[model samples]
Target: MQIQSGFLVFLVFYTLITLVLLHAVYRTSQLIVDEEFHLRQGEHFCRGRFHVWDPKITTFPGLYLISASLLGPFKACSVYALRLTSAIASIVNAYFIFIIRRTVVGKQEDARVLLESISLAILPPLYFFSHLYYTDVLSVTMVLMMIYFSLKEKHNYGALLAFFAIMMRQTNIVWVGYILGWRALDLAMKLCLPNENHQYRLRDLLTTVQTLLGSRFMFVRVIKLIFSSYYGYILNILAFMAFLYWNGSIVVGDKSAHVAAIHLPQIFYFTLFFATFSGSELLTLLPRVLRLVRNRWYITAFGMALFAWIVQQNTIVHPYLLADNRHYTFYVWNRFFGRWWFARYLPVPIYYGIVVSLAFLLFAQHNGRPPLIVSSLVWIVATVASVALQQLIEVRYFILPFLVLRLVQPNVRPSRKLVAFEVAFNLTVNVVTFYIFFTKEFYWSDYREPQRLIW
Candidate 1:
């Protein structure tokens, strides 16, 4: 019965998505923004022109190759057909979220899980890209599939999906490292003695480390365990290194525009981004925040100070951010964060609050379990590695980290009311953003084409 209901929910949502895609295709029949590059590359693949490459495209050809496979039967790639690739990938992503939720929650496969899956599937930032011909949707889908398979103890399949994810975006190799760390931690927990208090303490970890280092035989055994469990991930990492060596950089093209840098404020921006889309849940964290301030006021104060310093020193306004009015980020930066000197620092407290709340939630969920703690730490490292060097302040970059954080915390279920609010919030944002994209048109002086606002 639950399965039937889940299917019905998916069908309803899928129908809605299809209608949105059709309308978007009809209105924006010509390629827009990155679609011009993506569609042309996909068309190149469709024509079997493998050697011809676009100098502007930064990622690998995974999106085009996958779209070509699906469009092979028709022998042509239309605007609608290319956009359908991501639209369909979005549905598959919803299914992967559902299964990953079930896997994380163990036996609790209730209606709420289905609702949570659908909520995440239609998250405004992610869902917005589904109507366009961009790599974000398919890229996110592959990563989610990798996480799902990893949770199912299917590391080999997970690694394969991770490869596909890397092909979609070179930076995704960081996530592969995250999975490798998670799998290694899981193996370490299994090898170590069980904790009596059900909490992984510092002493237990020290003892485990000592035990592994105490004997060459034990060290070899642990090494064997990692190799047996995560050899596929190791191969993926090695292949990625080879690609880096051959290509001379992570990006395939447009190297000057996508150069890496120390953008520490990006993480702060991510906290605010998470808080915004988190709906009523952010408000619910206030009580915990108060308790934290009462208990660890010094730590809280230091974190806020650090966030302020990062914002003061490391806020980056990319050239594209200032030049492009077509993205919502342009107005967001111009109207808010970039408008005044204090404006950038204004969100520092919110960032600190969200980070504290997230830490509290993580500790509460894991109860200091070593594997889960290590996994959380691994995710943080992966997220920082993924976005800290990104020169552009793109919200789409936050999608994978946000989804992975939610997926890893299966025990943290929002109230049904909150869930409903989230879904409504996402739908409302999608409607408004798409409406603006279709209705609001301005022309660039340099290009003769009309530009529309988009996420």
Candidate 2:
């Protein structure tokens, strides 16, 4: 019965997504924004032109290669067909979400798990690109699959998916490292100190590390365990390093525009983004947040000051961010943060509060085990590595991090009201974004094509 209910829910959501995808294709038949390059490259692959490469494209050719395989039977890669790849990937992502939740929390067929999975699958930022030929949907799917496999102790499959994820986006190597670390910690806990209580505190982690390092015999055992279990992950990292050595950079092309930098404000932007998108969940945890603020006022004050300094020093308004009015980020920057010189500092408190709230939620105990210890540490590192060096403020960059955090945090069970609100909120955003994209077309002064708003 549970399986049937889950399948039914998935089917209903899938039908809705397919309708939206069809409508999007019918309305915007021609390529828009990044689809122009994506579809063109996909067609190149379809025509057996393997040597051709697009200089403007930064990520690897995974999307195009996958699309070409799917379109092989048709012998022609239509725009709709190419777009369908992401839509299909979105559905696969939803399944991965369900399985990951089941693997982590052990409720295989809970209705709450079903709702959460579908809700995340249709997250506005990610759902919007499902009908477009973009890398975000497929990239996220690969990463989620990697996580799901890793959690299931299938390191070989996880490593293979991690490689695919990196191919989809070079930045996903951070996530690959995160999974490797998580598995390493899991192995260390089980093999070295199985009798110890798994409290997952900083001290516990330190003790575990000290014990492993203090004894050469235990250290050798852990090394053998890692090599026996996680050799695939090590190979993946080594290959990535070799690629970096050969290419001299992570990006495949367009190195000039994709330069890495110290953009500390990106993390703040992500916290704000998380608070906004997960508002219902945060609201439910409001009392906990208030208590945290009341108890740690000084830390909160220092955090706010630190965030203000970062915003003042490291806030980057990329050329694309200012020039691309089509994306929602432009209006957000222009009307909210960039409205006045003082406006940017206004959200410092909010960012600090959200960070504290997230820390509490992620670190809080559940059933005698920390919600996340090594995973949370790895997530912070991976998130910082993924976003702090990025010179752009693209919301797509936050999708994987948000999804990973939401998935691993065992306490993120939305109430019925919050679940309803989350679904309604995401659907509303999707409707509004799609309506504007289809109906409110204007022309860019430089280009002859009609410009439409997206994201």
Best by lDDT: 2
Worst 10 residues of 1 by lDDT: 363-372
Best by TM-score: 2
lDDT over C-alpha atoms for residue 148 of model 1:
86
lDDT of 2 by residue, 47-164 (tens): 7787888888999999988987888667867777777788788778777877787677666437667667767877888888888889888999899988888887888899899989
Return the lDDT, model 1, position 372. Answer: 56
Residue range 309-428, candidate 1, lDDT tens digits: 888888888999998888889998999988888999888878888888777655554322333566777888999998898989999999999989877763545677887788788778
Off by over 4 Å in 2: 366-369
What's the distance in Å from true for residue 378, model 2? 0.7
lDDT of 2 at 321: 87
Pairs that clash in candidate 1 = none
